[model samples]
Target: MTKQKGKLGLTARIFIGMVLGFALGLALHGFAPDSSFTASCLTLFQIGGKLFVASLKMLVVPLVFVSLVCGTCSLSDPTKLGRLGVKAIGLYLITTALAITLAITLAVLVKPGIGLELHSDASFKASAAPSLADVITNLVPSNPIQAMAQGNMLQIIVFAVLFGVAIALSGKAGERIAKVFEDFNEVIMKLVTILMNLAPYGVFCLMAKLFADKGLDTLGSLGKYFFLVLGVLAIHAFISYPVLLKLLARLSPLMFLRKMRDTALFAFSTASSNATLPVTLETVTKKLGVNNSIASFTVPLGATINMDGTAIMQGVATVFIAQVYGIDLSLTDYLMVILTATLASVGTAGVPGVGLIMLAMVLNQVHLPVEGIGLIMGVDRLLDMTRTAVNVTGDAMVTLVVAKSEGELDEGRFNDPNAAKAEEEVHLPHGHA
Candidate 1:
């Protein structure tokens, strides 16, 4: 325990790396554009960014597998998994719809779509959305291995719950399986700790590379639209989440936020919720003191389904693209945009380059130019980070809500401002033990 708590935790070091790397990136880009500098800076960028992401990815498969299995078996009654599923999906839908509504409402008032040049010449064809039949069929993978290979969250979830229930019902046989899984969970979690030790170097590189390539000018041109989306996300995160966590969950949002910063920064830098999954899982379980059972099940589902941030982006982008192309969308078109974005949030969420897909769907609905997606892709690298930050926030928020409803949340740790310290006490010594 002394060894565990004596040093700065992985999160603190990684944060320091990110800040230093980001500053170095800006400095290199601004003051040293020469070939040698560029070459040297690229090395720094790769060290901080690529390595961090790769290390994180290394944790993904193990983390998800172990955490999900453990989360599944820990349920008091395996049947409650069904109830948890319902609550999580329901909360996700309500929040997603609310998010888009808020974003669209703000867009209309802000008029972000008005007076933008709508480029018609760029030919961008959108892939057809899968039919409802296909969506349903894809949910239950016949081969679970194939599902994991595909990183299909919904299918992975269905299988994990089923596996756990099977174990729960089998008496002694279930105990044998559960014990094996528990050991595997420990092994995988240890792998996560090993990867975490490399976080500082990875974070430093990723942050530096991002600010170096992505300039403030990207935001300057679309400043209004940017702020509209940003403001909506911020309001939802700071204002909406606090009220819910404080009132409904009866926890201190300030304490939650302080503990959440390390994972939040990782999400902001990586821009992939899936990529951020390992860290998110660790943070929620260890720092926030959410039950591993809840964190494992809810966090992945949240990454896949709780796309309030993406829904908001789709809402604003639909308006922005419509105005850029001089397309005058009526009430029906706006309504369609809302419905389409809300639905697509679930379908296209785990898809890489989801922004393009969502934008494609929105443009097709409003008869805006599909190629308008390219206009935003340059700045999207940064915006992706922001949206991801919101996405994870939604994930943690919903997890807290469901945990509270089930009487699973650790209110004592959650209310303490130094929740991270409590987390170290719970998880750190366990590892050594």
Candidate 2:
């Protein structure tokens, strides 16, 4: 018992940080109100929180590029890459389509927006979505360095895969380069380990600032809309993913969920798929027993393209906003929403404010007033966090399925509760454990 309680593990520490930070934020909002002192304190917290998120972002591009290169180079059969990509991407699109369909069906039945009359003076102007031609053209980077500089994940993935394939096809020279990439991969993962140790403080600051600024009123004002989205997200994460995992991968859903606790918390706190990529990569490969070859490719691509949680929000929010505005969508319009959102998952990859951006596109397609988005924007931050958790969960689920299909999954490591614990001890600095 004493050994168990001797030190706080990463997951427990992070949960405590989140709970304390939320309580602190609520107390400040309720007691301090508009005090200058509260304002100053929150400003400090925001800086610290943003910095921590930035630190994570700094690792994303290099980690994805190098890890991907390493994984690709290690692949002896080049044909496997093509097959793997097809399966991983196909599953992502199917699941996303399913998610939006579920959301729309539930929204139409529940009618969360039927009677509520909401008027917003605020306006939303969506950035122009790229044409299909433009999206396809941009897939192959004109300049790989520029893609990395801009953090264009899809383009980066393309270049890394191609570059790694070239290295794999090359002779002795390729072998040397592959060795260098493997070394880089190891170093970068160690850096991820270091950053994770700081996560408690980062999670604390982020939650504190968010709750301090937004408070509970935002949720209260949009209770129906908020809960509807939350319910759909919960269903997708808990039901949809587990069902697929059990049927397709023959894996234990309970074990998958148990291992996901730490990764899910990271996603919830960050609310950016890109920001969560490093941790997701670590968890899927290290903790979940997915081979790096499969995880390295699927996880990053999933982060770039998969938006199941966002699709759910788009479906429910579209219906909610339409009902609020007294605009009824036809069956055709509903189909269009599903189509538009599913395609937009890929179309809007790497775009900033992706959920709202895709929502704008869907509204335009269905001829709903785009400005209605302003009505629900207030509570989006919270919903974004929840949806992000779902998104990463989907990422892991797909990784498991694909790995299992390819015979890349390690059942022994995956089924062992002590797998990740033992790995962490191995990776720990000398004298730490």
Whole-model lDDT for model 2 versus the true structure? Answer: 0.90
Total colliding residue pairs, candidate 1: 8
What TM-score, over all chains together, does every model reach?
0.90, 0.96
In order, candidate lDDTs are 0.77, 0.90
Q: On residues 1-433, what C-alpha lDDT tens digit does candidate 1 reach at each position?
A: 8786457765677678878977887787777755687767787777657766767766665667667877887787867888889998888887888888888888888888676654656556667765446766888879999888777777887788788777777889888989999898877766666666666777778878777766455776677778888888898888877787888788888877777777788787778888888878777876777888888898988888778788888888877777777667788988888887777777755433576776787777777777887666666677777888888888898898899898887877676666555334234455564
At residue 412, give the lDDT of candidate 1.
76
Task: Report the Cα lDDT for residue 14, model 1.
Answer: 69
Q: Which candidate's lDDT is highest? A: 2
Candidate 2 local lDDT, 326-398, one digit each (tens): 8889999999999889888886563225799889888999998999898888899889988999999999999
Candidate 2 segments exceeding 4 Å error:
1-6, 350-352, 423-433
